[model samples]
Target chain A: MAGYQDLVLRVNLTTGKVATESLNKEWARDFLGGKGLGIKYLYEEVGPGVEALSPENKLIFMTGPFTGTIVPCSGKLGIITKSPLNGYILDCSIGGSAAVEIKRAGYDAVIVEGKSDYPVYLLIEDGQVELKEAGDYWGLCCHDTEEKLKKVYGDDYSVLSIGPAGENLVAYACITSDLYRQAGRGGVGAVMGSKMLKAVVVKGTGAVRAADAKKLMDVTYNAYKNDLLTDTNLWAYTDGTPMIVELSQTTGILPTRNFQQGTFDQFANIKSEAVAAAREAKKGCVSCGLGCGNFTRVGEAVVEGPEYETLSIAGSNCGINDLGAIVKFNANCDAFGLDTISAGGTIAFAMEMTEKGIYDFGIRFGDADKYVELPELIAKREGLGAELALGAKKLAEKYGGIEFAMQVKGLEFPGYDPRGAWGMGLAYATAPRGACHMSAWPVADEAYGEGNPFTIEGKAEMVKDLQHYNAAKFSLILCDFWALSFDIMAEMLSALLGEEVTAQSLEQAGERIFNLARLFNTREGLSAKDDVLPARIHRHPLATGSTEGKTLPEEEFIKMLLEYYSIRGWDNNGVPSGEKLQELGLR
Target chain B: MIIIELRGPLARYGCEHGEKGRIEAKADNGVTVRQILNQVPIPLQHVGLIVVNGKKGSLQTMLSEGDSVVIFPVVAGG
Candidate 1:
């Protein structure tokens, strides 16, 4: 417990009560922190059958042991809740100083439950906590709200605020912090809105104490110099995520035209070089040395990024090649606190439905003029926005075209077209939060690395190992950009916590956390049937590019899924076995 | 002569002639892709993907005259 804050803050908005309790040390030992710890809390506290956007739901904010320390890229705050979009467990990591601020304020986690009668925001300054009326800031955009809060609380305070997308209860609404950083998936902001809470502001003056400062510093400095600053990790600083646009393009996984094609002819117009051409500045999250954030400006639009996901999902997938339009769309989404992936995916699905004569939303692919205006509409839930706000899953259910809806578990797919990367399809289908690229990116090894992109052979084990690795890595709250191995992670944790941590133990913890999440999903009525890709992926082959004439055959996908389940010690139904749970100490 | 293309940050290892990201290498009929890579100053560990004539290739892949090769660094992001 040397690295932990050893405290949990509980707030009841309806009754206007605030209290602090000791963190469960046993759970901390098993879950580590961040995503793992937060999910464990959610699984235990928020039982099954609770509606996501109701007062019965709970929102938990958590930070890892590495947070507030000298650990590099350790400033991620995990927001765990039931997703209003899909009624599933959702945990989103947001990069900013909020995690550090929360840890410095002497707590490992903050849990908010029940609903407030009026609009309010939780303000925490060291030992002091208050729920202040936020009626004045209710209707403001995320950027303006943060600015207003900073002006009132001084610049030292970090604010996490939701825009109109959350206030209006958009299913894919996101929570924005530090203006551009967001917990951007699965209606986390809607959960906040459902609680009638607008923002959480914090200022902490205390410092985190490392168990063995000398050893921790030495190990961290060594990794920072030898591993992090090397060519393997330097791409984040030189090009950031925009560099991946070309990688995904070359691998035939660019996800063009609502994933109907694997390649985009206009990819050059929105690639990393294009972003670099319009780049005005570079930014990074707290304690970050890589500084992967690219602050771009085109025409009058400015935003921290149209990161690779935004570029591929909103730009090429929508058939809009105009970088300026994508930049404006990115700014709009950031201002309105929308998940750009879901927004773009929903619009792209509509475009395809209209083109195919299934339904007409008066939008077409490559309509950049109309595309840029959608975030405001969707946030306000007006006219076309009302339909778009329902997200891709609901839209497909309402109209026809469920085959091309391009979502898994009601969450929209990210930039990768899984047909090109077979292992990536498995990663998406089995991801706990649904279609989440962050869960496990097998594309790196298959499409982007030396491994064959179009094969299922050896893919099951690869995906399983990668998922476990990412689970542990995110629990430590390190940036995914680091690409450091498990050995490095174990060394750092061992030094920081004064415990004999090993790569094997960390992996076991990851497996435990992953299984616990699966159990939570099973208890909520999800089974192997829920873990599936859309018909477009299984039935339709991409028409052109390196992946031309390729489809992840349904039979092949089933084989891969069974193999993955077996590897994870799960039953054929994708439920963790009693023995497996006991092995991970879950039972 | 075989044409070699570098992408993204690997463009720094491009040859002196042709374009900024392109290189022309004289390769024997039996030369492996590893041999051609060894002839350049590019870091082998940093190479994530190797494409030969638009198809995925490996270090053991044999090279021939007029072959086109593209090399890129490991790509990872969320």
Candidate 2:
């Protein structure tokens, strides 16, 4: 495959050795790339229940065949590892130039294993690879660290670095790149921190060799570009995700007051219209056309988002609808290298705990004056920040109020409240990296799907198809916004690999990846019980908004899961049978 | 008079008519949202959700005087 460099860079930090190996063509064909190939590597080398931050585990940095090519929205870097926040096999896909830089640097994936005795950072320029001492750059925040690297390596280098949160081993820490873009979930940053690796800087002057450059460019410009320029995409381009503030608000799914309700009365104050006024600049990721990132000004600090998830969790859910405050809060998290979703969800949990008299951090819902001070403490594991740094699951475990912790499998949910869209409920439950919307965004179709968004019937099917499609696309690693249809993915993959791989085959590959992730978890003692939603979602019916008085019936939801499991060739316990594995060639 | 607030690109139609987003138009009490949308210059496909007074309503939903309609596009986010 011309698109794939067919090289895997193996770095042993402890041994201080680096080796370049030929790509496993068979695994590449079976697993595809990105998350798919990512899991294949992680699954093979790491033991079933290996400690997440252990040197025994490998951090696989992967890029797809479309990466570094003319493919729109293709600069996706997949960070695959056992999560320090949760025990699931996690693949956090981040957008930026790093993936493209990695691909152009002559490697499909870079598997970094073994812990370093001292802090170091890996630098890759074309084929030249070296592990340089990073002690001087260790404690800098994400933004400052990137600036320091850019000063030394020049602007051409694409740096993926961590910050104080990672250095301090914040459980929900994330890896930052391209300034604000991140592999933001599942504590992948902590994994990097544990390895004593500060950053992976790549400078690629070489062009990615695509299978058929003309065909790839033609299809990219003609089909994907034409469709993306339409009105729907125009909205994304203009407002980015700040528009979701209104959509979620007007539809009564804004995730307000610790998720006790779905509507936030103050939504207008923090919505797209408000954010647009504060927008100092629009940021685009690598090869991105839909560029939805907002670099908005708040006070003297100019920060990227406090996007939908941050706005919802830290804004509405925390009972603070001040957009500027949210922006500052967002900047603090990015500097501290915390996952904004997890950090915001954690604060919301603490507020609810204070309300319930379970614990007091002097926080309250509809009031977040204290949150601005929490991120730094959380990153440093200082004072109450230490307890709160454990995340919602562990906090709720120790202090009580587990019912409203707003987390699944130790991962916090995004802004979408599931009562309004039932498919999201299933998506949250079944996500391999815990309650992640990226696993598959059924909420998109469900919110826009025909008839009632409240319908239970066909939600399972919609979630299933999306999971498979996204799973496959994750390896091709196209952004969901880019993968509007499978035809585009199939055509591009075929053109890139110079093979006639259809969307059908690609989706099949996705199913294989999903199953493999499940297998990794099951091997680590995952059960059907793990495939369950938070009790708050099932029991607490929304008291206000579009989904007022709606909640998932627990037994019915289980039945739906059973149907989904059966559809996916799994048994009652949500385990994929041997025949299914054989079918995917995973056997 | 029925008040309809247009969002995203759907605002373009109202903008062309010298109305900024929120357009006031007369419609019979029982007219479907589809009918009102058809009367507007906007391409109906661009409108994903038709929220009537803060609730998700379908195109076939009946519209009435004093009822506010907010139309949004079917775009996605992370």
Candidate 3:
């Protein structure tokens, strides 16, 4: 309780009412904060059959106990809501100073509900909160809106805004903060657009108190020197995510040509070295020592990343090797507030559709010129962009190419090709928020480590454990870049809360949180039937590179899924059992 | 001579021997990957994946002269 502000801010745009309430201490104790806490709020406030874009769907912004503290890599803000794209429980963590600002504003969470008659932006300055008219800022891009808001509110405020993509209700529209960082999946921004809330700006000067400040500082400083700034975690600063491009290529998991192949011939042109060569500076989130962001400029394009996901899905998956073009595409997505992974996956699917004469959008693999122009069109919902805005699953549904949509549960696949790392297939399918890589990343152990990439022997346990680990970690709002173990997290939590916290307790909390999310999804009618990979993953084999002739056999995938459910104490239908629910106190 | 490539922070190991990221090491035919790694300053835990001739290689993987070995750090997240 010492690490918490113990306050919640609720704003109803339709009624023009803003009120503050005490934090749900029982829920906070059980779910902690960030993803877990945010999802718990959504499950309680929003009903099972709520439409994601309707006013009934609430948008919750949450911060964790570690936020605004000296805990390194704890600056990520969690946004939770029903996904407009997939109609599932969606939670996304974005890096920036927003979490710190929100916490300093003396609140653990901010809940925005209902729709405004006109465009408005919520401004919270210390204890003062008001809904201001955003008519002048409504049509601008994410960057311009942030810049204009900063001009009026001064630079000390943290701003989160949407762009044309969100305004047009693009299915994969994302929310942008700090100019570049985004809650970049599952149409959270579309939900914001639906409420006609263009931005949320916060300026807080309060401090987050710790229970044992001396012990917390000692742990923080020790971890900062011994655990955080070490060889195990320095890769974030040294090469960042671009290093994974080569690793994925070498291990035969790099998605290429819409996943028809596992390797790209032009991978060298877009690897970490290429990013470093174009790097102008390094950036990081608040309270971060290992700045993973590489600010790169190529010709007229300037952006923070074109990270591994963008580099793979937009670069090789599209058969376009031009790094400059990929950078331009990345800048376009940031400007338009579109999720790059979904945008790129949809385009690649379209390219294959065009090549196969299914439905030609006049775009093909390696068409860099046409590829760079699609994001804006999609954001504006004009011309071919209108069709592309539907995303891969919806496009495939409207059209006739469902098998190769490269999506699971309506969300597009990330960079790693699942055929090469079989556990990834399970992770993607079983992810609560559609096909999200952050839910669990077993490829790091299988394709990137000493584990066998082609086996399902320990994959079920591995995926389940990793999923629980990630769920708990994200709930604490820690940055994924830190590879600290559960013990470190428990130690920090114990110090901050003035209580005994153990790794075992944290792991149990993780299980409880994961089960609660499953309950949310199942309540909305998602079940084992929805936990499925694209047909191409089961049917198509890669034709080149180290993973040549490899496919995740359908039988092996099913065995893994069933085994995963068994290990998770779930029934054959992937529902948590009564005994398991009772054990987690969810009964 | 076997050409060894080190990536990310693991490049420090290669720098200890020959170049910054690349090292030309003398190894006999049929030498194991563990043996080659022992000759370097890198801790085995620091090595995430070992690749030999574009394929995944284990610690016991046999190494021959003129082979190419790439060592990566145990860093994963994006």
Which candidate tops DockQ? Answer: 3
**Per-candidate TM-score against the hidden true structure:** 0.97, 0.97, 0.98
Q: Which parts of model 1 have CA positions greater than 4 angstroms off? A: B1-5, B8-33, B52-55, B60-69
lDDT of 2 by residue, A534-560 (tens): 888889999886678988778778878
What are the clash counts of all predictions, listed in order? 0, 1, 0
CA lDDT for candidate 2 = 0.84
Ten-residue stretch with the least lDDT total in model 2 chain A: A444-453
Worst 10 residues of 1 chain A by lDDT: A229-238
lDDT of 1 by residue, A1-587 (tens): 68898899999999999999999999988999989999999999999999998899999999998999898989899899988877788999999899999999988899999999999999999889999999999989999999999999999999999999999999989999998898998889999998989999998888877889999999999999988886677788878888888788877999899999998999999998899999989899999989999999998999999899999999999999999999999999999989999999999999999999999999999999999999999999998999999999899999989999999999999999989999999999999999999889999988888788888999999988888888898898889999888899999999999988999999998888888888889999999999999999999989887899999999999999999999888999999999999999999
* DockQ (Cα-based) for each candidate: 0.50, 0.54, 0.69
Better structure of 1 and 2 per DockQ: 2
Question: What class would a CAPRI assessor give candidate 1's docking?
Answer: medium
- The positional error of residue A351 in candidate 3, measured at the CA in angstroms, is 0.2
- TM-score, candidate number 2: 0.97
Residue lDDT tens for model 1, B23-46: 787776678878877877888888
